[model samples]
Target: MSAAPALASLQALFARAVVAGEDEAVLAHLAGDPETARRRLGLYRRAILANQAGALRAAFPVVARLVGEGFFDEAARRYGEASPPARADLNRHGESFPAFLSGYPHAASMPWLADVARLEWAAHESLMAADEAPLDFDALARVEAAGQPCLRFRLHPSLRLVRSAWPVLAIWEANQPGRDGTPDREEGADDVLAWREAGRLRYALLAPREAAFVEALARGETLAEAAGEGEPWDFGTMLGRLAGAGLLCAFSRGAAAPP
Candidate 1:
């Protein structure tokens, strides 16, 4: 085999050894004592899995709390085995954990568990999103009235919307540390908004009309279309709230795009 291909093959085998616990194939390529190499590979495998599990634990603390640490650890191990890290940064791992839990037979009893995980993931993403300057309301006011309807808006980069058939917001709040793990009312749907502000994570349940309006905007709908989603509702008040909370980041007229 060519030198480059042979080296790439060796690297792939080593990765499988450490990530998939497949040691036998890679053992033949080792230069040192076979037994020693096997032992070292085993140690590396365990460390990699441990680091992955730690990342999952940090990102899904509420999930860890819902399912005890023992169960969470096993689940994290299975997740790593099935879908090993594709990137070096552990912080970006476990994005599909909520989907994994959805089909997890052991968690069938708690159908809403996946939704809660989704909420947590949204919060994690929001916290990691890039910072942005707040919307320029003065520039917006100067736009001619004729151009208002065609104006598209940009929500904060840190904003995330989560909708679930279960009362996920209530469940997430109830599970917070030192709080009793009981939701005030547990039998309804929830539309939630999670975002980061001033270096802190904040989330709240959004009213139905408000959720629809914000969602329309997030989809890049113009102001007129977004307003239509919440007809008869006071959009001026809603816009004010968004600005006050640092949610609206920018806007554009017609085909012009926000930076």
Candidate 2:
């Protein structure tokens, strides 16, 4: 075989060994006479495993604390092996971990664990989402009443809405530091909206109607149509809340005139 193909095959074999948790097999594949090659490969595997574990642990510190260090490490190792990082960005590494935990056998006992992870992931995503200018309240105030019907409101780039069957917000709060009271797993369902405001991640529980309105708008519904879908979707209340939370980015006074 050509040198290139031979080297590629060797690299693939090494990768498989690392992924399969077969360190001995990997050591055997290195140059038989060069003891240093086996040592170096082993070191490389250790470093890679450590890096992967650290990235996941950082993203899910609350989950790690909930599951205990040992259990969390084993679970993270298995997940890392199954779904190795495909991108260079470490911040995006644990995006699928919540879903994975939901189906994992060990986590089956903690039914709320997955939802907690999901909440944390949403917060993390909101913090990293693209930044945008806040809505121009002054300009909006100046728009004529005749142009109001044609106006289209825009949402902030950092805004995110998540609705969960479980009380994810309560679960998240229960896990937060300095929470003096006992954790209440049965706190109830939640509809949460998160966004980056003033360079900090901020979130609040949304009412059913408010959640519906925001979700509808996210799907490109005009304000009027979006409001129609929810309970009186009090435009004044929704706009005030969103604007206060920095969720409104910009808005156009009128829809694009037909070409």
Candidate 3:
């Protein structure tokens, strides 16, 4: 083989050995002597495994607690091999872990595991999402009544909406450090809206109408159009709750209509 192709195959083989916990025969072609090459390969394997485990653990502390350290460690090891981190930023790692857990054999017993992971991931994402100012009510007040139809509102950059087929909010709350006093699991689902308010991550469980209302607004529906999705949407109550919770960030007098 040409030098470039040979080197590329060697690199790929090295990565496979380290990530897949495979035999170390792949290192025989390294430039160094056989002994030196094997030692170097071993060092690379250890570092890769350690880094992957560390990142997974950091992202899923609650998962670790739920499953216990030993079980979680083994699961992390297996998952790391299957879905190695593709980015240098560890914070963005485990973005697909929630989905992974949903289908994992052991996790099937605890159907809520996936939803819990979803909630935690949402909080993590909200923390890193871009920041935006709360709605400028002052700007809205200055607009002409006739201009209301042209106005477009924007949600806060850190705002995130998650709807689950399980009681994810209750599950998350019950798992909280001091919330051990709650009753045993019940049957139901919940829709959660999370956002950063006053520099803190805050979340609220929304009713069907409320969730639909916010979802419509999120899709660029105007106050009038979005409210239309939820008949008798109680615009005053819904808007008041959202504004109070800092979900709405800013509004303009006129902008493009909803898609």
Candidate 4:
């Protein structure tokens, strides 16, 4: 019999063993005494768990800090067992970590933990997003009033806006290094903005209205339409803010790329 099919079957079994976090099936495939094979697989499982947990720590620093190293490791292990890394790159792992935390029974008490995870993921993704050009003011100025509704503004790819019921920004900021003392732990709703500018990651907490306005623009709403979404949001002032923060990139008519 050809060995190709056997190899493929082994590969599938190995994946199941890893995902299910059980070693018996995979250990049986190894040519050794059952006890020795189990011991080796145990070591392999430990190493893989450590690696997966390490990635989660790097991606969600605040979450790890909040939960502490040991608890975080257990959580990461559980997450890995449920969802193994489908890709080789570790950076791509933990995309569902925020959602995992939200539903995790142990994390139920910390209602805002998931939002903090969201903030961390936003920061992580912003750093890796592709760079884009600054907003073209001239193009925006050229659009006629009649066509303003269709004139869509594009935010930079690296710009991420996170709206949360909890003050996640305050929690993240307090955990950051080099603070003079404990941060006030600012409470209440917030719209946290994260973006990479000049190779540095920038974060800010925005008011609800401003958040609404920016979110609308990010969704490809026209300048006129976006302005209407946020109560008391000043378009001219926001325009300057977008320019200063380097968040705006290009404009489009009906979501089509501008010429």
Candidate 5:
């Protein structure tokens, strides 16, 4: 093998060892006494594990708080090993943490934990999403109200809806700062809508029909088409809710056309 590829492989192996939380056979390639190599690799492993766990904690504060700091620390360490960041940006890590929790035997006691993590991830993603212009009410008004059903809408790029079978939104809200009571150990189901508006990220729980409307709009359906999808539908109320949240940030005839 060429020197460059060999060095690259070694670097990858080093990272793998740290992520695995054990096995430092790669250290054999480095120049040092055996004892010194063991000491250095052990310290390196601990530091790397700690750093990755810290990043995970930062990204999933609610999860940490829910599980308690010590439990989270050990779990995060194992998670870092099993699902290490695939990208250089640590902020992009923890995408699979919810899945990890869902399968972890220890987390089985908190079956709704994964759903809560999903909600947090959506919020985190929205906060980091790119900026965009708000929907132009003037342009939308130009279209005849009758023709509005044919008008396709584009949600803000930062908009995300997290639908869960568990009452994840309630759980998340209950854990927010300033709440004085312990959250109930019960599960409920709903959808969470998250979006960035005017440099601020916000989230709200959506009613069943409302979630369907938002989903339809996100899928590029016309206002009329989306409204038709729900019974007892009120286009006025739907538009009002969307506009109030500033979640409807873009819509154009071209983007709405069947591709």
Candidate 6:
């Protein structure tokens, strides 16, 4: 193999050894004695797992608090072993943690825990999403009335929707530091709207119809189709509400769907 490919293969093997705790394959490639290499690999494995757990803890503080430190640590370790980080950006790690919690034996008792984790991930993603300039109303006004129906509206890059059978938004809010850990009512559904506003993360509960409208637009539906999703509701008012909230980022007069 060429130097580049040889180095790449070695790096991949090293990552697998550290992440999967299978260092034997990598021992032969190291410079030192096998025992010393094993010792160094063990240290690397511990440090990698610790860093991954720290990243998970940072990303899912609400989940960590709900499960307590000891439980969270064990769970984080198992999670790291099961789904090792595929990217260097640790901030983007643990996106699958909510799904992991759903099937986790210990977490089954707390059925709502997974959804809460999902909401937290949404909040994290919203905060990390790239910023975009708000929609240009003048450009929108220039489109003729006949061409408006097919116009595709672009919501803000940070906008995210999380639908849960449990009142996850309330649960998340109640668990905030210094707040009483009691949600208003625990038995109902919540469709949360998470987004970044003025550099701060914000979340709110969305009405069912409003969610449908937004979701349709998110799927690259045209104005006519999205407006139809909320029948009997004034599309103008709905559009105005989203635009006023700085949620509408841009628009395009074409049939192509959003990338």
User: Using Cα atoms with residue i matched to residue i, what is each candidate's TM-score against the true structure?
Assistant: 0.89, 0.84, 0.82, 0.88, 0.86, 0.83
RMSD of each: 2.8, 3.4, 3.4, 2.9, 3.2, 3.9
What's the true lDDT of residue 64 in model 3? 67
Q: Which tens-of-lDDT digit does each residue in 1-259 have in candidate 2?
A: 1233467777777886656645554455555554676666667777877788788887787788788888888888888867778998878989999998999999998887887788788888888888887777898789888866555667887788878888888767776777733567676678888888888988888887788888876666666766774345367688788878767777764454211
* Overall lDDT per candidate, in order of appearance: 0.87, 0.76, 0.75, 0.82, 0.77, 0.85
Total backbone collisions, model 4: 0
Tens digits of per-residue lDDT for model 3, 33-73: 76777777778877876777678777776776688877777
| lDDT at residue 14 of model 3 (Cα atoms) | 72
C-alpha RMSD between model 6 and the true structure: 3.9
Error of 4 at 7 (Å): 0.9
Sort order, lDDT high to low: 1, 6, 4, 5, 2, 3
**Worst 10-residue lDDT window, candidate 6:** 1-10
lDDT of 5 by residue, 58-150 (tens): 878888888998989888877776787778888877889889888888999988898888888888889898787667788777886666667
Q: What is the clash tally of candidate 2?
A: 0
Q: Put down candidate 6 lDDT per residue, 1-259, tens digits, no spaces.
A: 1233377788988888887778876777777588988888889988987888899999898888888988998899988768877899999889998999999999989999999999999999999898987888998999999999898988998999998989898889888899778887777789998888999998778877778778989888998888784336767776787787799987888788644
For model 4, the stretches where C-alpha displacement exceeds 4 angstroms are: 1-5, 16-21, 144-150, 179-181, 229-232, 254-259
Better of 4 and 5 by TM-score: 4
Q: Tens digits of per-residue lDDT for model 1 on 161-200?
A: 8999999988888889998788889687999999988999
- The best candidate by TM-score is 1
State candidate 6's TM-score: 0.83
Q: Please give the lDDT score at residue 72 for candidate 6.
A: 93
| Model 5 TM | 0.86
